[model samples]
Target: MDTTPQAYRPETAILDLGDAFYDPVTPANFPETHLRFRNDRAAAEVGLETLGGGEWIEHFGRFEPMPGSLVEPLALRYHGHQFRNYNPEIGDGRGFLFAQLRDTGDRLMDLATKGSGTTPWSRFGDGRLTLKGGMREVLATEMLEALGVPTSRSFSLIETGEQLERNDEPSPTRAAVLVRLSHSHIRIGTFQRLAYDRDADNMARLVGYVLRNLYAEEPGDDAAAQLLDRVVGRTATLAASYMAAGFVHGVLNTDNINVTGESFDYGPWRWAPTWDPAFTAAYFDHAGLYAFGRQPEAIHWNAMQLAVALRTVSEAQPLIDILETFPERYQRAVSEAILWRVGVVPLDSTRDRALVQAIEQGMTQSGIGIDRFFFDAFGGTVPADDAFAAARAALVGYTARKPRDHAYWSGAPCSMLIDEVEAIWSAIDQRNDWAPFHAKIAAIRHMGEALAD
Candidate 1:
């Protein structure tokens, strides 16, 4: 392995925030490190693209702290509402923030691990991650990123030689450790923890830290209100993006909602096959609480929780005012997101909203698959077929962002439907053949590059 000095400028800014926010923890020793997936695109962000597979496995899988980074991992402390019920006991039980580095854009990013070890919050269960879960997350992040969603990038995935017992899936199942590169790991629950304790001083300090790190350009005066307003906008944008992508996050717990507005911690997630508003991703969600259509509501609920937490530092009225803007922000964002995905520049807000509304109605009435609708209607051009006549008429005058002459515009769009994901997993699980999975990832990346322009 070439151990050349890399351009990884490490930072421990989070560690300097306060010891009350996290507990120091050690990573588990995996018996084996079998590199399964490496996100070269994400690696390039942090200047780690030159590292060999062996070197990557040793550093990520083995939990070795990158040089000049944090010497030890930190299990972040946070309390969240799980299913609207407050759970003060929940925290990072099976993962830790391994290191932090500056990306090519000079933005701070954290290299965090999942299924790598145990922490004080582990309670009574083993701190391990199933290999299937890791694979699913990698696919979810890749697909979501390609769809232009602000999301965490799956940086590395390495299989650990272990058989784990679980009731959720067939067990004993294989295990692995995953490292995700994300903008930040701080969550709404992080503030909830301080508010729960009624520690106004620490709450104020946290607000300052977040404002400086996450929103550096914002005015320092009334930072709490400014942060809440920014969070509301970002959260609204996130909900809109999910809806436009036809993604159901399944879990919208406050802890799952990152403070930086970047989506991470993929659990039970799925893309809607059709335009079913009630479609759910988790089997346990019998009530459809976090269903496809209800995601905006769920996110808004989480934002209110954040506002409640911020009350410890600022007045309640300001936070409430910011929270109330969620509906308008979400509506505007949904229109903009749809326009972006359809590969067109919105002529105006009213026209864009009408176009989005028309498309949604058309999809529902015709029972069109979301992916197919987007693929066929690139640049807002509806098909000549009579079935889409209404949709075509709705977008007749819209202009494309660019000429739709790319070869990508001619084929079926890449989809991450459940069946396709299962088939990819089955090939690896049954035949031990990873060719399908690799090929699917390559195709998804190609789609992403094509759409990125």
Candidate 2:
């Protein structure tokens, strides 16, 4: 928690190499490094106006901590059941909170590094991220943010010039460093680590820190209960957003769940082209643990894991009761989101149920284009044959490829209907006619403004 600012110097920045919590750093030996993207606007938002350039060749390959920032050596100890196997030997291996800054909005956020170097938790591997992996994360996170999902933003991408080998993908792979701006880098595993290690005192301190920093509005014993409730609510709402947006967070590990309830750690994630509940993006999810349809369940399970970790200090019954509200909250938020997306305001549960069920059936049967369907529907363009063909093409990529599911379509001539919409959409696709569409949606939204007057 060092508040004193120091002159920015990449060379003089404290490495804190001796901390066993991360992989030991060998001086970054790289041929070249590069800066692919610099989030100048995001950096400026957080009052970080200056940045030092790194050798592009070196960065694409080993990460060296950028000098000139306060290095807050944070060991966020937490436990997580990886794939449901409770493991206590987990912590910030090569990643740690470097510094936190209050942004222009006056909200405190962390500037954390991945692939900075190895720490005690670096069991037996190099602490470098592959260049491709880093790029994917940057793209995935930004897309999630634009889709209105609560997510971490990538601050910067620096190519660490190092030659590393991995079993998957090419050997002697290039490395890069990634910077993420998030509400808090603390995860559920942070709590589990202390709880399983019998470090209740540290767990208490960590919980207090979380409350003070992230859940400041909810404080004390009652506040802590409120914080859990807020987490539950936020988690449910976030899951609903994911569902509405057709996003599947491939990894829903307890350690990946943020205490602040913001979505971070996008890994092997994908957008469900069709509304299938069992759609999962993670290639390694042999058991379909964190699929698109199962996201709410996965979130609830993660929350339960968090509740168990929180039980060390907080009352278990209250936490459990709060966790139980996740399903209802998820259902409500998801229904409301769909109505909003479809340019309609939901009036009752009956309407919501009908719309959602219809959409699901359509997606399951004819395999609708989630984005195109909504956009076309919002534009009042009915689907046509070509549009259905495009949707079928999109569905070909699903893991569970169902080509002839009669129950899905309910005999709706989706192909012809979608093709009709496709014709209208095709005609206007290139025209920058945001004016009309914007006005239409705006009018619908401002119907309230008119009513109030």
Candidate 3:
């Protein structure tokens, strides 16, 4: 994993573990290659920013292998607990790991695809991704990055110009292909599959691979416990950041919990309209299992599942000890995230707790939109209404972290509320109008720059 970023340090390192973990597959050949989006920001990190439109289409849309990367795409194998029901038959049904490379930060990043084609795991379904779904994912990743959430970057999106029928969205919807850059594709369910098969050798092998490649951990007697601890902390921080950013990862299942702790696979994702904890993203979520407020609980439960799988190779007591630290870690991370969003230097634990309560209570009472609330509190002051008095009092002694003179502060905060999201998509769906979509991306990126430290 060379971190020097010299013309893309491509690697096929995942093959060292052999082909049992994934099946070599081919991508679908679409009738048309219509370019829709390209993320130059993400490409620059991996030294791929110089690709022309033809090269981009040739490599991403046509699925041609990048030189010195994976010779063939690998459809990864794993089983997951979908909505808490154990399903041992699920894996990368529609997508596959296309390539692996090192970025400028010395981190291992993966180039994977969605709606690319079908694979060995494509059970009873067409492995095509809807164009509208791809459009939504691009917007979701862009907005999440702007809001400072750790997430997979949407590197490329191309409309395939195919018509597919489905029950979820409008039938005969247009089709697309999506390429995302992520820290790691390894998930908790990856371990679950290994543990279920009782493949002790591969389990240990996979654990070592993760520890070295993702966690930068030394394979010692305590390596398993060490990796678990790091994962728990990262997951806690991710959950805390989501809460601060007002993100609801509609489907927080075990398979979706990447060991690196970045959020991805935006199916029914939504941002909270206000401070409503009961807001659901996926319409089928009648149980509220992965609602806004319960996200921390859902994340924690996924960590527990990881611990359960690691027990096959490590001591139970050490893993349990690490799991016990989630609550405190989550609380501290939440406080830090809130203070960061509020643009204030943090104080002691007691004051931070009071400030959290005050800000949340004020948000709940005032019904201010989440983005607007944070925007108005840029200098740690909201309206002078009595509902905000407690926040003002708790924020009295703190100093602002950054000056609020950026151009973004001169106007209302850019937001991704559901109606606006639909409007952006409807324009594309009805009239092929992409001006609104591109404009929103530009605004979101501007906001990200303004918020950058």
Candidate topping TM-score: 3
Question: Which parts of model 2 are misplaced by more than 4 Å?
Answer: 1-31, 49-69, 72-75, 346-350, 379-453
Writing each residue's lDDT as its tens digit, candidate 1 over 109-152 gives 89999998899988886889998899999999999998989999
Candidate 1: segments with Cα more than 4 A from true spot: 1-6, 384-390
Compose the digit string of candidate 3's lDDT tens values, residues 317-428. Answer: 9999999999999999999988888888898988998899899999889888899899988768877878888988889899888998889999988888899999999999
TM-score on alpha carbons, each prediction: 0.96, 0.74, 0.98
Model 2 / residue 19 / CA error / Å: 11
- 416 in model 3: Cα distance from truth in Å? 0.5
**Index of the highest-lDDT prediction:** 3
User: On lDDT, who's better, 2 or 3?
Assistant: 3
Q: lDDT by residue for model 2 over 177-202, one digit each (tens)?
A: 77788887778787777667666666
Lowest-sum lDDT 10-residue window in model 3: 1-10
Residue 87 miss distance in model 3 (angstroms): 0.8
Clashing pairs in 3: none
- All models, RMSD in angstroms: 2.7, 11.6, 1.9
Question: Of models 1 and 2, which has the larger TM-score?
Answer: 1
Candidate 1: pairs in clash: none
